[model samples]
Target chain A: MSAERYNRQIILKGFGEEAQQQLLRAKVLVIGAGGLGCPALQYLAAAGIGHIGLVDDDTISLSNLHRQILFTTADIGKLKVEVAAKRLQEMNTQIGIIRHPIRLQKNNILDILSRYDYILDGTDNFESRYLINDACALLNKPLIFAAVSGFEGQLAVFNTPDHLTPSTNYRDLFPIPPDKGEVANCAENGVLGVLPGILGTMAAAETIKLIAKIGQPLTNKILSYNLLTQEQYTIKISHGGGYTLPKTVDEFLNMDYQDTSEGPQGYAEIDASELVKLQQLESTILIDVRERHEVPILDKQIFTQVPMSEFGAFMSKEFYQKHVVLICQHGIRSVAAAEAMQEKYGDAKKIYSLKGGIVKWRDHFLKP
Target chain B: MKIELISFGKISEFINNQNIEVDGIADTDTFKQYLENQFPALKSMKYKLALNKNIVQENTEITNNAIIAIMPPFSGG
Candidate 1:
């Protein structure tokens, strides 16, 4: 690397040749090449991090261009990892950019993650987040976590250095995943174009700080920032003292993240189109679990009104003869209702929860 | 004792109010039970409770006149 290219950060008070050397030797693996990864990768590359890995299998769609700043209009159909790598390489020829153009699944995460000195999570789902956290903990690698939704963003440093006072991981923050449909994705809820940019840049700053050993990193704590109100909150996370994390790769491989004994909970769930198919059968019954007062009420004649609170009282063996579908305000409650019904009735009934409930139905079947 | 409760992100949308004052809530666990009972819609959503700017594990006690916050995972990025 040229001296002129790195002089600005090197001349800073405490950071000089020693920190610059550390940054040049540090290796980071960033998962997800969408909104958050773009800005993080750009900054890390520009900061002259010696080796960086980019992982994402998604293609750049036109919708992503508004928030994903790495690519232009012409790069829409390209793979995110490839495009990001090329751009990062062009930005800093001194840094090494490795592209993994595949999804981060349990099968390959261990091998790929072990190679990096640090991991930065820009993933968009809970499953991936948890998986990455476990892998990082098992490997004793520090992770920089960032997430954005709507007008808000959150950043945290998890599984920090052993020398730190006390360290915490993601599970300590969110004990479990939110039930499906309980939380909406950016696709469903929408987000401010700049939210991820701000958060991702913060993520990059944390990474640079971790490598360069500059200021205090956000380890053992979480910082939530809301762009709308311009408010920020930081909360300390205490070590839950140590618990059993997946110790071996095989244990992680055999891990069943879906559901318990009765098998995958999602198996008993059906999408909107499937509900339409089952509706044609005479034995199929659609039960609306939403309260009567809820808006855009379903037609009373076509569906039975059995609010979830009263769902237990209406159960019977005869319901087993038909394909019973539970519907609620959104898909989440219906699944909960279906699980309760399944517990009471066992497998005798062909019970199904409407995947998105009336909200999806209204969007697809009813609303103009 | 009175405590102020705050919620953020989608959890805030479900909660509606940015801040609320409550009395007679004993600890973090009781406060959570109160929240779930009051807003049945929150039963399924995942969230963390922070008492006075500290994230507490389940059943941790809440001191009087503290600020409690409800936060869910912001998984958008």
Candidate 2:
């Protein structure tokens, strides 16, 4: 460890050589490299954390540049872990930066988390957060949790390994994950560029405090902040029920943290190219389920316009022997339409939905 | 008694105004019922309620001029 690099933090009243050494020996794993993970990784690296892990399967895109500060425009299309680990290493050569350019699934979470002393959840969804919480709880590893949306953010430290007293986990705060599309994320709803920076740094601060024993960490309490009004506060969170987390690796593997798409079962999903192949057949039919006003309309006259609102009306009067393909703005509503048609038409007609709808069709086949 | 209701994040979209003044509400439970009745959309949202900046899990009595904060879980980074 270079004494000159971390001299500023070393000079703080009680945070001296011993605390610096503690940081030098600690191992922390950050789950995502986008938004919050970028700033937390940077600050942790600058503070001389000895070992850090970066985990993300996503690649850098133009949209992520506003908040994911570690990546530059030139790094677009590169894996996030690859880009983040390189940047972190350039900043602090003494630290060990492990790059796991893969999504954290049930099969690998324990193997990855067992190697680290602490885990930082920078994932942008409830599924990953809940999975991390359960795995950390079972492993007795402390987790630093943080999330940001729009102008507000939340932070908490959970599973601190203090068994004598009760501690709260994410499940205690939220017993179950919200329904799909119930909570809007930064992608659907806009987020202020600087909000994640502010919250991610706070998460890093908590991690350092826990590692170095510097200050009171935000354990068993959640801190909420709103950047729009600059109002911030912390509230105590308690376990509501006597809920037990998965004890064995097998149990954890069986847990379903993500909300699976509840589209109709046994439905065929055809890609744009596959649809084109099927279009050559004389009996193939395409039904546009989107509203008539929707843009990027299909120029092919063979496509019948049957908006979802009037799907029931169209089904009542028309009976066709042709192979049917349903399409909407996105594949979600189209899947539902396919399910409804299957219930009415049964196996009499072969049905399919365009896998990603017209937007994907345009991207793959129409774009020049 | 009158209490000031403040909502945050996506829950604010369901409420007509960010801050609402409710009269004749004596407890958090009734206030929650009133909110659900007024904004049916809020019934589906996952959130926690804070009274005077303190998170109260049980139905606590609402005092005069108290501030109740309605906060929804934010799953973004």
Candidate 3:
């Protein structure tokens, strides 16, 4: 290791040559190359975390430039993992940057996560959050978790025991994943560019503290930051119950993390053609969940007008249909309705949401 | 009793960031029940309650003038 490169951090009290060496020896895996991942990776790389593995299957788009600082405008359409790895390598030539350009799934997450001593979760979705939390818990690896939505951001360290407190995982806070469309993500709610930047950097800071064994890491504690108010608070996370955590590898693999809220278990998202096929079946019921005033209206004879405004009332009424197909303008509301239906009828009725909604399949709906 | 109710993320949508006065509620369980009853939307949302910065593992007593924070899990990057 070049002593001159890390002189600033090494010269600081409590963090010296030994602490810098510890950072060089640590293996950290950061999942997600978007907002949080980008900033965290930048600092982790510059700090010379010896072996860093980045996991992401996302391709950079024009929309990602505001906060995803690693990618340039010209680098748009390139794989995020590839671009991030290249930029991080340029930032620090001494550290080894391993790029795993793959989406983490139940089958692949364990093998990849097990290789690293520390795991950083910067993934955006609930599915990945719960999956990584459970996998890290099962693998006995310390996890640095960070998330940002709208004006607020959250940071926590999971699966790492603190003095007098046994460790706490994500599930200890939220036992079950919210319905897929029930809670809005960064894409849906929108986030301030600087929000994730702050949270991600703090995630890196916590990781560094944990690695260097210096300051107290946020183990079993969650910190919430509000960008709008510039107010921040940290809360202790106690061991929570009422949630099932897969204890064994076999149990972990068998657990349905993929279809947690929607998909095979809850509801299926289908296309226009599939809708037509299901239309022929007498048991199928097509419900338009769009607000009454919106859209080139569907045929009243076919679609039962159940505006989402009064969906709560609609849900209470009994329906005879075995297959329920929900449609809306952009298909977003339909998925929400489908989720509600799925929760109400479980496996008794098959619920489906039109993938692109009526707007995408305008010709099919407008046909005489 | 009066308590400062601080909410973060989506939980703020249901309960505004302010000081709320409660009369009948005595513990975290009853306080949560009252809050959810008042803000019906909160019943569907999952969040953790912290009293005076310490997360409540179970139904704990709510002391007067205690600072209570409600935080929901954020799934964003």
Candidate 4:
């Protein structure tokens, strides 16, 4: 390792060459290269972490520029892990940056997490948070957790033993995941650019402290910060009962970490052309989930209006169609409708949502 | 008996982020029910209650003037 690159941290009173060496030998994997992951990865790489693995399946979009500082405007449409790895590598060439451009599923999570000594969870959804937490607990890996919503953020270190307790995972706090749509994410509730920045940086700090054996890390404790009031508080977490944690690998695999907020779990999102093609098939039904007063109307003969306001009543009636396609104005509500249909039909019928919604396919709907 | 209540994250939307004077709630279980009735929105939300900065795993007695924090899990990155 180059002493010249890390001279500042090496010369610190508590952090000497020995601590720097610990950082150099550390292997940390960060999930989700969005707001929290971006900042955490940057600082972790800059601190001269020897090996860093980044996992993300999303592509950079224009809307992510404000908080996801790793990507540039020109880098839009590029894969997030690709761009983030490139930028982090540029920040510190001495360290190794590994990019896993894939989403974390139950099957793939264990294999990927086993390679890293420490796991940092910066994912944006409940599905990933619970999955990573369980895997880290099962593998006995120290986890640095960070999340943000609106003007507030949370930071915690999990699965690492402290003086008073064995260890505490996220489930110690919230035993079970909330129902779908009960809680809103950053996309639904907007956040300031600096909220995740502060939380992500703190997550990196906790990781570094854990690696270097510096001052006490946030083990068995969770910190909450409010940007609006500039006030923060830390609460002690204890082992909570009433939650079932998978004990074995088979149990973990069998556990369902449902994707609650993103979209319909077990359905397909098709485009306008695919919708047209399905119209030719027998026993195919197209549903418009928009409100009665909204937007351009489609042909009544082909389209069936089932407004979301009265969807509960519509769901009680049985339909014999084999293929059910749901559509909305912006594609957001259609996903919600698809989720409901998936819950009702299960594997008995095929469910699909119109990608980009009717607004994007106005011409196709308006024609004829 | 009175208790001080604080909220964070999405739970803050339902409960104001200040010390609230709660009365007649002897335990965490009853306090939770009281909160749900007071703010009907809290019924659907999931959160953890910390009494005096310690997360309560089970129903614990609420002392007078004890600080209670309601924290909701944030899914955003």
Per-candidate TM vs. native? 0.75, 0.76, 0.79, 0.81
lDDT score, candidate 3: 0.87
TM-score of chain A of 1: 0.70
DockQ winner among the candidates?
4
| Residues A1-368 of candidate 2: C-alpha lDDT, one tens digit per residue | 78889899889888998999999999999999989999999999999999999998777766689999999989976788998999999999999999998878788899999999999999887778888899998898999999987788999999873434377788777767676546762124577778999999999999999999877898888888889789877877766653568989888888986532222233466767678887888888888898889877775586788999999999988755568889876566787798787667766777788865765556754554
Report, for every candidate in turn, its global Cα lDDT versus the true structure.
Answer: 0.80, 0.81, 0.87, 0.87
| Candidate 1: residue pairs that collide | none
* Candidate 1, A18-79: lDDT as tens digits: 88899889999999987899999999999889999999876676668888999998886578
| Ten contiguous residues with the weakest lDDT in model 4 chain A | A258-267
Model 3 chain A: which ten-residue window has the lowest total lDDT?
A258-267
Candidate 1 Cα outliers beyond 4 Å, as residue runs: A162-164, A185-187, A241-244, A257-368, B16-21
The full ranking of all candidates by DockQ, starting with the best, is: 4, 3, 2, 1
- For model 4, how does the per-residue alpha-carbon lDDT over B1-77 read when each residue is reduced to its tens digit? 76788998777766886666766779999998998888888887888999999999999998888899989888788
- Model 4 — interface RMS deviation? 0.7
* Model 4 interface CAPRI class: medium
> Which residues of candidate 3, in runs, are more than 4 Å off?
A185-188, A259-368
Itemize residue pairs with steric clashes in candidate 2: none
lDDT of 1 by residue, B48-69 (tens): 8898898876577777678888
Show the colliding residue pairs in model 3.
none
